[model samples]
Target: MKIHKEGFGTIITSTIIAAAIIVPTVLLVMPLYPVLGWITVIAILGLLVFILSFFRIPGRQHADGEDLIVSPCDGTVVVMEEVEADEYFKDRRLQLSIFMSPLNVHVNRNPVSGEVTYSQYHKGKYLVAWHPKSSTENERHSVVYKSGDKEVLVKQIAGALAKRIVNYLKPGDKVKQSEEMGFIKFGSRVDLLLPIGTKIEVQMNQKVKGGVTVLAKW
Candidate 1:
């Protein structure tokens, strides 16, 4: 396992805060209110652990195939349906949405190996990740990947608790399947717009791991 690069600043800040609280509690509070001080210490440590866990990247063999599209993030599949893509394609597409909870890993990966053709950031409302309208209404960074003749759009959307979305790929950049494409701070959602008539491999409400779960096939 490895800590994500994105968590360094957060982890450092949390450590400082934890130390500030723990040192004072141990020296001042523990001398007077031992139980309360101990409780405070445990609570602060637990929160710090959770913060570290959020950025942990566990080692695993990622799924890969020439025609397969892997999941781009860890979460539960909240939406799987056909919809008219209004932003980029402006055509019919099969949409798959994954809702990332605060407890899940928030790193986003590339679903396929291809050249990035479109990358754009949209400023919008911060709706809850699982909300039906959040896919289009929430602030998001969208990227389109082209492999051979097939193209797919992936959107990193900000949820109520997620205030920042970090995307690394831009137009013309070559990305590999299951590689890091971005990271969403805190909880968020990811949307994939696949070509119509593509075979859907996962079902709604199914849990998926980024770079590990097979999402579809071309």
Candidate 2:
């Protein structure tokens, strides 16, 4: 699979950590394998953690169309309901939330082929990603996309464990349904607020693939 460009730093840092643990264990502790076998096991597990955390999977492909809607991130659907977007842009919308566990790929993808009309990052507190209050209260980057007449909002939110929220795309940038937009560090979430009458394809607690699953359609 292709490693995402946004995950380069994560991969590099993980590699360095693995090297530090393995080389030192083999060179300095290999001679003590009989007595320090547990130490060797610890080193092996450390390498495994880094490998899993930094790994990225290529997004699944789908046919393109004007009415097509794509999943915004690779994670499990945590919230799916009609709710009011009360904070930045106050309006009633279909809120479909995806919870990004640390094990899942943290890269956020554009939900549709659109021209970004508005994009801005808000500095705020790190709240639990799944918390209902987190949607409007947590640190996040908001992106409004215009695909023809459709306007949808995607928010990259920081969880309690995630301190850094990386958004690479800016306002006015054209984005494709399958293109990468940003990566959230550690555990986080992505919320897509859609207009009324948008078909809800997925339900709460369901798993969804970025760019592969259709969450809504105009």
Candidate 3:
């Protein structure tokens, strides 16, 4: 319901655009150059793009169950593969990968309520979100929450354009479903590896709201 301050990068971009236009108008208007006026228009357009990227849409759903499964990130479902998870799960799982573009909201949330059982940061390569090798190659933060008799592992992977990944939770930190856990810079992807036989309520290509839509149910 509230639009928080945008990331520092986004704020800097907006500031550059605003100053490029308004500052010149106040200091260089004496010359009355027509070229500068046109430039001002372009700069203002850039500011709008920065605003859109920082805007946050209100969530439309809430959690009401002991094991509710909220969407881990705001993005379109691009992949649902049967792959063996790297850690924690170790077994084959239904890996639901959501590709978050630079335009998508980068805030990630807890999908279920539980204790933080495992958390690890892997410094690796920055690959494309959809790249099959990205799951192993990308710089990723892996966090596992043991909730309702199941262990849910959420991996925040930084893509080629993303340079920073922020995870706010730590060991023993009790996270609630839909609570803000971290934010990914620019663009990246979040992969949720669910246990086999878990009921998935989302379709492949469906747009999901982080902390809102239930991707699955135990």
Each model's total of backbone clashes: 0, 0, 0
What does the lDDT read for residue 86 in candidate 1?
82
Write one digit per residue (lDDT tens) for candidate 3, span 111-180.
9998998889999998888798888888999999989679889999999988888898888888888888
Model 2 Cα lDDT, one tens digit per residue, 1-218: 66666667766777677677777777777676745755775767776665555557654665466787888778899888889776455778888889998878777778889899888898888889999888888999999989998799999999998888888788889888867788888889998889889988787888888777888778
Worst 10 residues of 2 by lDDT: 54-63
- Per-prediction TM-score to the true structure, in the order listed: 0.98, 0.88, 0.87
**Global lDDT of each model?**
0.94, 0.81, 0.82
Q: Rank the candidates by lDDT, best first.
A: 1, 3, 2
By TM-score: ranked, best first = 1, 2, 3
Q: Which residues of candidate 3, in runs, are more than 4 Å off?
A: 5-17, 20-22, 25-36, 48-52, 55-60
Q: How many clashes show up in model 3?
A: 0
Off by over 4 Å in 2: 33-35, 38-49
Candidate 1 structure, TM-score to reference: 0.98
* Better model by lDDT: candidate 1 vs candidate 2: 1
